[model samples]
Target chain A: MNWLTWRQHRAQFLFGAATLAVITLFLVPSGLGIWHTFRSTGLAGCLAVTGRDCGDLASTFSDRYTGLQFTIPLFMILPALLGVFWGAPLVAREIEQGTHRLAWTQGLTRLRWMSTKVVTLVLATLAGAAVFAFLLSWWSRPFVAASDNRFSFGVFDLRGIVPVAYALFALAAGVAAGALIRRTVAAMGATLGAYVAVRTGIELWARPHYEAARTISYSFFGSGPHPGSGDWVLSTRTVDRAGHLLGNGQSLDFNVLHARCPDLPGPSSGFVSKAPIQACIQRLGIHLQATYQPGNRYWLFQGIESAIFVGLALGLLAFAVWWVRRKVA
Target chain B: MTTPAALTATALGKRYRGHWGLRDCSLEIPAGRISALVGPNGAGKTTLLHLATGLLAPTAGTIETLGRTPGEDPDLLPRIGFMAQDVPLYRSFRVREMLEFGRRTNPGRWDAELAQGRMDRASIDLDQRAGTLSGGQRAQVALALALAKRPELLLLDEPLAALDPLARREFLKALMEGAVDGEVTVVLSSHLLTDLERVCDHLVVLSGGRTQVAGDIEGLLEAHRVLTGPRRDVDRIEGVAAVVQQATTDRQSTLLVRTDGPIIDPAWSVHRVDLEELVLGYLGQPNATALPAPRLARTGAEVSR
Candidate 1:
């Protein structure tokens, strides 16, 4: 059974191997060069030193290596590709060719067939996803450090174990869709759509709420309790004395000065300079409120997101098995 | 259940969407007999075969193969072989790979020697990709796979549809020759009444989601005879009034009757009915309630013979 599965999926395995080779070929030299430049140009030295500005070194390093950074973003669709090519075709091809009936009646029980085929493909997916994430994380170490921000959306998804989860979830969704639809191309399209919808939905709507975001409110003019660059600042608002949440922080002057400083002489003319408005806001004791997920919770968020996707993947897989056993005609 | 019949169904039915595909289907096929399941396009022959293979579950009642529930026991799968319509093969796989698939999946039960012998006789090369094979070649390969598994029961659905007349004759010969060597019970479904008549001794005719007629060919043929008698209703016969068809002219009546004993009416002249006429008669009138059922109720002992 295992041999049969391997023979059936040999092309997909070869494709995965070739992709891993290509990625390795491209990223290894580029990553080593980035690390070398970081050390050779004294950027690493400047960062380590306490009082050094590191501005020139940092800009020089960024200028030299920024072009290669765009290469990493191309792999953003790797999980989607796995879903379309490897996962969706797994069962749909069998059904389309009518080999599913052949296999099922070959004294190969449905349980063994599903376990051998689905498990091997999903395991391959896990390995491929893990390798890509590891390579990208290693390659992006310099960039992540220089910006002091790895918690951003695109960077966060590709740099940690969540990519592995995403790939597994995509593969499982593809297999499930293939089992249900029984047509290869349509199942691939559905898998792609579902993978994007679910991943982005969780990233956009549910990720921030994984943990209650801590908020810091400080006086408008005075910078206090500043959010770290690594922190994911979900929202920032400037409130007036009446406590209405302001839209954009740039319009802080319009929101505060007119509301609390009605007694000021500038009621007839808008102040072009910043001195009077700052003084008025300082006197009014207005504050800026910012909500953020702390930087230290990066691994914690990874764990939570990975758990959700893995759970979903398992559920989809179970549904697929049920469908194959009971519903397939 | 004295000695379990090779295949048994009790009020078996299958439904697709909202409509019944096979309804009130009940029959028993004895072991070691080559039975032909004949039906027209919408007669649920494929549905019944798939249900017996456990590929399609029943919507009502039950089906058992080899004295066990189909697909329920792990051990039962290896004992049964099925060739689906068009004899589906992994087109991407070489013929050798398909053989290997059968061998691996069946474990110790695969008869590699028999499979190779059949393949060689069919003139199919082991290295040829299944996609490149002709329809006749595909059927040969599929049959080899099923026979190679050394199953006690073999079910084939429309295996001859892919063959030319000559090839179908050869294929049926090969099937019987192969099945006879292993004492295998084979139930094959097809629309070719002529071909089945030549090869099969047992018969099952399906029409309107029901088993219109079923019995051993010799018994069915013996029970039914064309009777030419003075003009009268078929029910006026002195035995089981199982008239398949009745045609009356001004002075005489000719009717096909299936009965428990030979018609003894001296006013009647009786002639034998062939397999083709018998099959067509049942299939043509799907709504006929007076079934030619003398052979329909065969005892287990009678079937085992």
Candidate 2:
């Protein structure tokens, strides 16, 4: 049964392997060059000096890797491709062509036939995803080390163990859709729509609530450092000393203030610098209250997100098994 | 020791949605003989064949083939060979690969020598893909695959329906040779009764999702007679068990009937019924209630033989 499944799906498996190989070939040499440049520029040593200053060195490194960083979003499409091409046609083509009758009546039972095909293909998908995640994460190590901001949506999903989970979820969704729909092209379409919907929903609504965000209040300064660059700021608003929420009435109150203090910059000024606004807000006893998720929680959030996707994948696979065994003709 | 019948059904039926494709069909096909199942379109012939082959499960009662229930039992698969309607095969596979597929799927039950001999004799080039073969050649390849399983009972559903006359003859010839040499019981379904007259010794007639006639061919033919006489009411004729058909004219009447004893009406002429006439008489009347219920019953002589 294993041998038969491999023979039937050999074309799809080869295509996936070839795509992974091409990606590796493109990333390996360029990744080595980036690492060499980072070492030669003493950027690592400067970044290690923590409290001193390495902003200039970090900016140079960011400028050099800007082109390669743009391709990070392309890695997200790999799971959708696996879903549409490898998983949708797995059973849909069998039924659409009436070859399922031929396959079901053989010596093996229907459950065994379904399990053999699904399990083998899932393992193949996992292997391909593992290779991809390793290559991309290794290539992005220097950038992550210098900048230390891996919590962004695209970078987070494209780098860690989460891509494997995403790939598995996509495969399971495609299989479930194929089993229910019983048509290859329509199942592929359903898979694409469902994958996009779930990913977007999680990224927007479900992810932030995984752990409660913390709030902090700080005095306003003209050109002083506020929050760290890695902190994902949810929202920032001005509040009184008692921590009561204050609405943005700067336009009306500041207008009154401008009438009272004729020395302040007028509306006709080409540019009103931040110094006056800061002095005015400080005198009014207003402070900046900001909510954010700190960067130290990156891996914890990744683990939680991966668990959510894995749970969905397993649920979809169970539905697919039942649908194949009971509902399919 | 006496062997069980090749197939036995007690009130077997299959329903699609709310409508019954086969209803209250009880039949027995005897072992080691070629039986012909004759029916018009939508008369439940294919339904019965599929049920027996385990391609479908019955909704009502029981059906046992070779003394075991059909479907999902690995032991039963080795004993039954079924070539479904239109002979579906993997078109992408070469003929040799298709044969290999059968061997691999059936594992311990395949006969390689028999399949190779049949393929060679039929002049089927195994190197050619199945999609490239003509309809007749495809049927031949399908038949060879079924026969290679060495099944005890083989059920073929309309294998000859799409063939030309020459191709039909060749296919039937191969079937007969396989049946005689391998001693396998076979049930073939078709609407053309005359074509089955020469090869089939056992017969079953079905119409309107019901069995109209079933028995040994010679016995069924012998039990019926066509009597032509002057115009007279059929009830007046003595020893007429049941009138299957009646044709009246201004001067004379022709009656087809089943009789238990000799017809004592000296004014009438009695003629023997052939396979075609007997099958046609039942098929012409979709409603079997018009005929006597007792006489419509089948003796199933082959099962008891």
Identify the leading candidate in terms of DockQ.
Answer: 1
- Candidate 1 residues lying further than 4 Å off, grouped into runs, are A50-73, A219-229, A240-250, A254-271, B1-3, B228-235, B238-240, B248-253, B264-268, B288-305
TM-score of each: 0.92, 0.86
Model 1 lDDT, residue A200, Cα: 85
lDDT per residue (tens digit) for residues B1-305 in model 2 = 13458998888888998899999887778898789988998999888987886767888998998888876465776688777777778788889988887787777888888888888878999999988988888888888778888889988888888888888888888888777777799999998877788889888887777777777777677778999999976665687666777789999998777776789889899999888877777677555322223434543211110
Error of 1 at B189 (Å): 0.6
Report the Cα lDDT for residue A121, model 1: 91
lDDT of 1 by residue, B1-305 (tens): 24347899889999999888899888888888899999998889999988998888999989999988876777788999999997889888899998998999999899999999999999999999999998888989999999999999999999998799888977887798789887899999998889888889889888888887777799888877888878975556675346667778999987776666757878898889999987887666564432224434443112210
Cα displacement (Å) at residue B265, model 1: 4.5
Residue-level lDDT of model 1, residues A1-329, one tens digit each, is 89988998999999898999999998899889889988888888777776566767777777777677666557778888888898898788888988787888878788788888889998899888889899989988877767657778678988889999999999999999999999999999999999989988999999999999999877776653433346878777887666676545645656446666665555457555666667777776567887888888899999999999999999999999888887785
Model 1 lDDT on a 0 to 1 scale: 0.83
Where model 2 places Cα greater than 4 Å from the true spot, the runs are A36-45, A48-73, A143-147, A219-232, A235-275, B1-3, B248-252, B289-305
Task: List the global CA lDDT of all models.
Answer: 0.83, 0.79
